[model samples]
Target: MDNSVLRHDMVDGLEESLDRFPDAVSVAMRSVPRHEFVTDGPYQNRPTEHRKTNTTILAPTAVGRLLSALAVEPDHDVLVVGAGVGYTAAVIAEIVGDSNVHAVDITRTLVYEARENLQRAGYEGVLVDCRDGADGLPEYAPFDRILVEASAVKPPRRLLAQLADGGRLVMPMGVGEQTLVAIEDGDVAEKFGPLSFKPLLVDGEQTGSIVRNRTKREDPEYEGRGWHAGHGWEQDWIDWEAHH
Candidate 1:
């Protein structure tokens, strides 16, 4: 089958499933070639987990739900927390120009592969860097829209602070039972529904890194290999209150 046809069929499947799939996001998803990121079953709706990278490439329905929650506008500065396979960024690039899209990943290998994949997908203008996802790309702070591909107990302070005035951010909120949440003005505006995703991780917690035995960061005693995050204890802390 033609890739374009496959893409359309994928979008059609999402539209039928979702209660209110945004037309813009549906169009963008259909426009981006997911095959550029995944070698197998690019149009499939099931998530393929990569244990090596400790990341899951979200299914198309999940992608549709995220973008619909993100509600990005053209030329909006958007930051994706987990670059993963770069398919989500490419889809967002179609909605907001590629140059306006920025992404970061804790896994160095995933960053390199994401950049290459975005380039192959004709979304090279999207900036992808290898860094702690919890840090929220400070140099490109103040984004109009922020999308976190991973789940967290709470929205990281850095990411919330980086949001432009009146900007919106969407992420899966929780550990065992996560919900797709939309945040604005530093508060949870809405909760889409139950969403399960891998927990948000810092530099040291990522796959293939040394185990985190110490709770506090020992900056002076250790060489600059692990614990690359600016703030440590915050990412470690858990917010117990459920969404009000």
Candidate 2:
């Protein structure tokens, strides 16, 4: 019934199941109360849907993998794309200091939700913004680590550009069979797993959200595009006539 007990069990499960789960990351994960972010089954090591967001609160083991891949250090500036409920950012803030963590979510509703969740978790210093995740937080550029929760065919160049030298960017790559890959200096440094995640969204495709940056036409052709929705770019950005 106690949050601490649940958090403890969550971390214990992670350490048992994952190889090379970093000690620092586990300690940070243990310290954060994930229940503040996801009110349902916060310690289950399973993904849970965020209320009304169509986004998932990542499993603790997945969070453990990303944190370990990023290799975060104390005071490191970290950017988290797709800040679902803010749990991942809060956990990272525990290791990197709340002031040093920044996050972005394309859905405005989730952005507000994440902000509230972080504040309630005592991580009010972490900044969460509503914006397309591919456009990494440039104001906080040169981040020591960047983690993108959504899957993409390739890392967004903007996110890669925002990374500080010697920094790492960990994200799920590919559409059909995603691999959690870590990138350094524009190259893949490591790859792990065949995970499944929702496609990285663009400025206009966020679920339950109205078209942002209007004049950005609502995508009318997406229903026929099959499984690769958005594919990290807006439908209008491509010239269907020329490509076809």
Candidate 3:
């Protein structure tokens, strides 16, 4: 199948489900060649996980919703955390000028590959750095928009501080029940649909560790005694009270 056709189908699928895709975000999605960003995958409306790190290039539907929610302007300074393979950054660069986009990842190898991929995708100006996603690129602080690809229980203070006045930040919030949140002025102003993403690592372990082992107790299926009885049951809260 032709890649362009696939791209159109992917975008069309997202539009059908989402009800709308903003003009700017739609244009960006159409412009970038997502196939170039991944070595092998369906490249439709599903995630393409990297074998080594388990970091995924989010599905077109998810990326469309996120970029649409972000509302990135052509001149806005944007920061993207966990820039796996530079696909999201390239899309953002297509919306904002490439020079206006900065992306960071804790995995050094991923950063290198992302930089190369961005260049290959003709987004050479998008800065790709190896750093903890929690840091939010202080050198490029005061970004007009910040997008975190990882999930966290709460917004990182440093990332929140880096948002320009009246700027927007979007990310998956919560360790157990993650939701896409749009933050403004240090507060979660809006919450979107549920999401599942790897937890953001703040240790700055630049060693390019592919696997960040999470506590087995966090998984609800772990022997059935784990916290949080699956999603939205609030069972974890009751368990916590009992333990206390």
Candidate 4:
């Protein structure tokens, strides 16, 4: 199939799935080349019916639907986690403008690929960093929007702390059966349909003694990653209670 034809088909699928955020969805679909973000594998050649493998590109419809739920704004300063191959980031770059998009991924290869793909698509102002998504980019703190591509048992406090007062965050929550959760003002304001994403993996391992000491010393309300530390739900619940 011609690349342009496939691109059009992907765009059409995005429009169909992202009916809610029409303008944002359309801008992303029209601007980002899906093929550039996908690998030349059996999955890319048969996206319509293919299930994504570990390295496969996410379905266009899924990406579009998630982006629609994010409710991004033109002036929003965005942070995208797990930005594989840069397709989603490129689309977001188009929607929020390149100057406002900052993306990070844990994999070095994915980072390189994303940078190349974004450049190929003529997208500028997107900064791709190879780092752990859970940690987030602190230097660019107080972002207007944050999107996480992977699922976590709980939302990371590091990521939440980076949100501006009114900033919004979209991420997959839960273990076996994940749901797309939207966080705003330290509360889960909206939830999309069920989604299954790979679990987030962070680096390093701390001893139980260290974890115990840290937990004891830290505020009871503050749960840094530690032994028997609760998931994102605990922190999210605390945040919600505090806000409410």
RMSD per model, one decimal:
7.8, 3.7, 6.4, 8.6
Residue ranges of candidate 4 with Cα displaced over 4 Å: 17-21, 41-54, 204-244
* lDDT tens per residue, model 4, 175-244: 7678999999878899887887765644311112123223233456554445334332233222233655
Model 3: per-residue lDDT, tens digit, 145-239? 99988877777888889999999999888857789989998888987788787677644223454322222234436526543322221113224
The residue pairs in collision within model 3 are none
* Candidate that would win on lDDT: 2
lDDT of 3: 0.79
Ranking by TM-score: 2, 1, 3, 4
**Which candidate number has the best TM-score?**
2
- Give per-model TM-scores: 0.87, 0.90, 0.84, 0.76
Tens digits of per-residue lDDT for model 2 on 78-171?
Answer: 9999898898899899998999999998888888999998998899999999888999899879999999998988898899999998999999
* Candidate 3 residue runs with Cα over 4 Å from true position: 204-244
Cα misplacement distance, residue 85 of candidate 4 (Å): 0.7
lDDT of 4: 0.72
Q: What is the C-alpha lDDT of each candidate?
A: 0.84, 0.85, 0.79, 0.72
User: Compared with the true structure, what per-residue lDDT tens digits does model 1 show for residues 130-225?
Assistant: 887878898988899999988877898889999999999999987667899999998899999998877677656667786452443344344234
